[model samples]
Target: MLKWLRRSEPKEVPAATLGPLQIVKPWARSSASEPDVGGGYMTVVNDGESDRLVSASCSAAGSVEIHAIRVKGPALEMRKQDAGLVIPPANQQILKPRGYHLLMRDLASPLLAGSKVPVTLVFEKAGSVTVDFAVEEPGAVGHVTLRSS
Candidate 1:
């Protein structure tokens, strides 16, 4: 029956959720140098009441801020979202490249591939939810399915 030839299904990484807010496929880009800046990406799904992603923190970085890109006179600049990002009820907020993402500044150490970064996300309604973000290779895009190492 060629049982050994059967391909295995890719295992999906676990998502963290508190109440109606679920953090899916959280990931961060790998850094090659110390004190580097990085971006954190993820999708926040709200199944019940609306919530606001107020802030985030991690041991890997000194500061984390929610940022959005805007065009200004033939140039692109990153602006901090002072009011934070909103996730409406029954909706989702996707944090990706060139859009909304977590700006990690003053990195304590290089974030190498295959490592995981534990981040605590504070929401207005959902409270604080800590999730481990899988570190991917440099310039990695889209959701990544992690394999157990």
Candidate 2:
């Protein structure tokens, strides 16, 4: 294949770290039928102190919110985390599917596979960090691991 024709690997963006907090393995699900909605996932590791994930934002969407899925009955419900997600000290907070994830609504455009979305996560103590979330297959169960060079 021609070098120019081959798709270039996305550059690795440094994790947002402040004090003891580090955001890692950020990724998102590709938008399918519902072009206006999508999900973002990541792991927030706190090695030193506890922190709070206050909010999030994405330029591709009108709003980005921290959310959790709950079993209300036979059906599942998604509830927004108004108070934000807490990152325990010496532990990690995982934002994944069917659990804690970022809910993106009013998307400017559908998120296609192989594309990327930039999300700004605001923390109470660690401040904020913008992560480039790789968009994976629409029905992807987990994040796509980027191979190290």
Best by lDDT: 2
Residues 2-90 of candidate 1: C-alpha lDDT, one tens digit per residue: 56677889944448979988899999985343238788999988889889999999998989999886545555467788899998899
TM-score of each: 0.78, 0.80
RMSD of each: 9.2, 11.3
The digit string of per-residue lDDT tens for model 2 on 59-130 reads 999999888876544555677888999999999899987688998989888788899899998999888878
Full-model lDDT for every candidate: 0.80, 0.81
Q: Please give the lDDT score at residue 108 for candidate 2.
A: 83
What clash pairs does model 1 have?
A: none
